[model samples]
Target: MSIKSFAARIFASHIRNKIDKWASNPHNTQQKVFEELINKAKDTRFGKDHEFSEIKSHSEFVKKVPVRDYEELKDYVDMMVEGQEDILWPGKPLYYAKTSGTTSGAKYIPLTKDSMPTHINAARNAILCYIADSGNSKFVDGKMIFLQGSPELDEKNGVKLGRLSGIVAHYVPGYLQKNRMPSWETNCIEDWEDKVDAIVDETLKEDMSVISGIPSWVQMYFERLIDKTGKKVGEIFPNFNLFIYGGVNYEPYRTKFESLIGRKVDSIELYPASEGFFAFQDRQDANGMLLQLDSGMFYEFIKVEDFYSENPERLILKEVEVGVNYVMIISTTAGLWAYNLGDTVQFTSTKPYRLIVSGRIKHFISAFGEHVIAKEVEQAMKEAVAESGAEISEFTVAPQINPKGEELPYHEWYIEFEQEPEDLDKFAELIDRSLQKQNSYYLDLIEGHILQRLKITKVPRNGFQDYMKSIGKLGGQNKLPRLSNDRKIADKLNEII
Candidate 1:
């Protein structure tokens, strides 16, 4: 074996040992993590304001600091952005990971010295865990191509700001840097199309062993590679074996990605958000990602069913049950206290705490009291694609509410297809059927004549891309909301189409 591969195997084995030790008694360690984070930030401005010193127990912490979304914490975040030191965390943050926002134009999340390492370490451990579980280390011998955002960062009030992927890319370890592709200059291209073209030019001939990115963007890269080389991904990168992805569900895109690669590769799902690196797929046999309990964050879960209620129960790790959707809340080393990250997740295992992301709290359609989530929509789409033998590139759903006359309101789907199904109506029927089967509320609504059947709109190729680009959110962790309550996104999509 090569020296790099040998070294990586050794590191993987070491990490596996540590992970096994950590997982042996997760409950105690998780509790300790909460205490440690609280103590660590007790002296910060936010901590003092929230009376963190007086907070000793989880219940007390919860009572002291109410769960807040980004907008609620914007005042403090804005203070930090305006060169205020010790506003959230001790001292100042190293950088700000800018994410797309709904009301606000951008969300500048703090990334501290402590939190940054957690992100890097969690990602490293994900690969290490896979290596330990599968006993495969050949992927480390060659190059790794991370299809990420622009590494170029802009400075604001002595704080650097960029996409999380780009920020992480800038901090890639020196040893791994030797095997990483797409030079910093290439990665700095602001326009995604231009950046992707540069990436294709730079990494097409390299000995690629692993590639990591959101599944959507990765598929785009694969399509571009195929068009350029007239060869499948496996031919272009013979040693390619690992695909690490997160951000969106891989189910709908799996068939198309497999076809592009020409074979199945080891895939790892992660739950890294702009807020923090939360979970990673650890075991090959597991259905959900193992929560990063030992990471520098304290986690809380509020049941999604009760989330809208006036008095929702906030459950700690020990209180969470398997098979319930929960809105994740966190108190982090980055000075976010009882912060709601907005994503919803369902726990598949509680002994070791493994979870699958259900959907976003905001990205759901409940216009007619038929609550349909991203997971359900994705599952329905997968069923439709399988039954229709069609290939979907991307899709988004929105409610068509309050028609001018007596027309019944319905769900509208904007779909971009790689391979359109021969029978469009049949495809639409299959999707509608799948949704009706999955969601009882939807079925009830249809039966009661409160809602019409879903409408399908086949979008022009790259319609989503064009719309995102038009809004300056084309790439880097910006995803189209799968389900929206209103026609805001739908109307925009219609305009694009």
Candidate 2:
């Protein structure tokens, strides 16, 4: 075997042993992890305020700390941002991860020394697990390109501020740093368009083995590479075999990315947010990601169906049922206690628990009583793509409420197409039909004449890109919401189109 493959095999074996031990008894591992986290933070202000010293069990911890969202915890985070130590974690955060603020205004999430390792380690474990399961380690021998945000961190109140990708880029291990592409100077470029161009220029002649990034930005890089070299991605990087991605569902972009690369590649999905690295695709054959139970984050679940209720029931790992959507609540080492991350997920396995992200709590449309979610919308789009043989680059859905009897209420879709179908009307019809099949309320609205058929507006080429550029949110972990209850995104799309 090659030297790279030999090294990968050894590392994979070590990671697999730890995973096997952790998965052997998830119940015990989870309890131990929670206890350890609580004890470590007990002396901190948040822990003491919640009576963490007196709390001995999971039930006691739950009773003391109530579930909270980002807005609710903003005040405490503000204190930390002002250079206060031991306000949340044992010390002030090393840096703050600034989220894209697509749903709300930009959020400043804390990243402490204690919590940073979880991000790094979980990412490493994801690769190790993939290596162990797939026995494909040649990718590790060559350069791996990670399309990330600018690495230049801005200082705020004596704390560093930057995107998660940028922050993580700084902490990439010294050994792998040598093999990682896109030089540090290039990564620090603030302008995404300029940064992508620099990346394409630098890595074009390198031996690329793996690529990792959000699908949209990576697709842009692929397009630019093809434009520059006049060759398919696989032909340009003959050794490239793995595509690691997250930030959004991959199903919608699968066909388009495959077409760009000119071949199929193995993929690994990760569930990492600014708050914590929650899970990663561990098994090659499994559909869901394995929860990072050993990560320094304690997890809880509140059923999505019960979320808006006056009092929602919070369930622990043992209590969560497979296939039920739940709002994840986490108490992390970074000082967030019972914090709601806003993302919705459903468990797919109980033992050695695994889950799939369903949607965002704030990113749903319920106008006209036709409650539609991200999953349903994505599924419909996928079906439409299959039936119409069209390729979509990006899309967003919003309710187009009638303006005082001017027109019937309906859903409006703004789509950027890579390859438009032969018949646009048929493509729209297929999407509408697929959505109806997924959502009974949507189907009822159509059948009962409560709403008109969905309207598909073909966005001009590069319309979404221009919109994002105008708003200064062009790339790196920023994504347009698929479904919205309001016309905030739609109104903006209207202007760009």
Candidate 3:
């Protein structure tokens, strides 16, 4: 092994031991973090208003601070944005990780001095965990390309404002600077297509190994590389062995990605966001990402079914169970308290507190009370693809509650396929049956004729891409929602089709 690789093994071994200690006793680890966050932020405007000083226990804390999304907590955040000190946390945030909001136009999530290192460490530790497990550090010596947002940042008031990925770019370790690809100037290209072209030109001939990015954007990068060289990615980057991805599940794209690579490359999943780095895949053979119990954040979960109730029971790490879909709520050192991230996750392993992000709170279809989630649709698509020998590039689901004529409203699926199934109708039927197997409400709707069997709209090649591009959201940490509650995306998709 090279000198760096040898040193990496030793360091990874140490990190592995450290992680095992906390993972074994998750409740205590999380309790300490919870206490720290409460103490640290008690003097802030929000803390004072919520009576954080009187909160002595998790139950007390829950009663004092109601779970809130960005919109509900906007007043305090707005004060902080307007240069008020100690509004949300002690002093001002180090940066505002800018992101597109669902209801609000743009959200400025705080990244505090205390919470920033945890984000960086979670990413670094994910790789170290891989190295420790597989005993492979050879990839570190090769060129590593992180297809990410432009590092160029703007300032609002006194705080640096940039996309979470862009802010992370500024923190690339000096040791990896020589190994990182696509020079800074190329990354700063504002236009995503132009950026991909620049990236392709820069890394096409390099000894690229570790490629990290959101899966959809990385898929685009792979397509461009193949277009340019007319070779599988494996042939172009012979040493490329690891792909680290985040933001979206890769299961649906696995077949397409493997085809593009021409071989199987190991991958690591990350659960990161502007609020805090939540989890990362700690074991290659494990079922789900390891919850970061000690990452300066305290986690609470509400069963998805009970999430909308006026008084939902909040369960701490010790109270959660496997297989139950729960909406994640967090109180972080970054000053977000009882924050509803709007993402729902299901525990795969309760012993170590590992979870899979199953879906989103607001990103589901229930127009006629079918209440189908992203996980159900994605799994159905995966099963159908396996059985029908089909290849899907991208897809989305929406409730078509108002179809013309006497036709019954049904779930509309816009699918972009790389290879069309021979019997397209049978393929759709397979997907419908699989979904019915997973969700009973959906099954009831079909059985009762409240809705017809789901309809598939074969979106032309690059149809979803064109839709995303039309909305100026073509790349860089952006994800196509797997399902929606309304016809907004379904209508726009039809426009592109």
The candidate scoring highest on TM-score is: 3
Provide the lDDT at 152 for model 1.
80
lDDT of 3 by residue, 302-418 (tens): 999999888999999889999999999999888898999999999999889899999999999999998899889999999999999888899999888888999998988889898
- Please give the TM-score that candidate 2 achieves against the real structure: 0.96
Tens digits of lDDT, candidate 1, 415-456:
998899999988988999999999999999999999989989
State which candidate has the highest lDDT.
3
Candidate 2 structure quality by residue, lDDT tens digits, 1-497: 77867987898999899988987788888888889888888888787788889989878877888888988888788788778778778978888999855345778999988899999999999999999998888787799999888888899988899988998988898778889989999988888999999999999999999999989889899999999989999999999999999889999999999899999999999999999999999998998999998888788999887898987888888899988878999988788899999999988898779999989998898988887889889999999999888999999899988645667788999899999999988898998999899889999999998888888888987788898898888988887777899998888888988
Full-model lDDT for every candidate: 0.89, 0.88, 0.92
For residue 277, give model 2's deviation from the true position in Å: 0.6
Q: What value of lDDT does candidate 2 attain over all alpha carbons?
A: 0.88
Once superposed on the true structure, which residue ranges of model 2 sit more than 4 Å away at CA? 100-106, 156-158, 403-406
The better candidate by TM-score, 1 or 3, is 3
Q: List the residue pairs that clash in candidate 2.
A: none
The deviation in Å at residue 232 for candidate 1 is 1.7
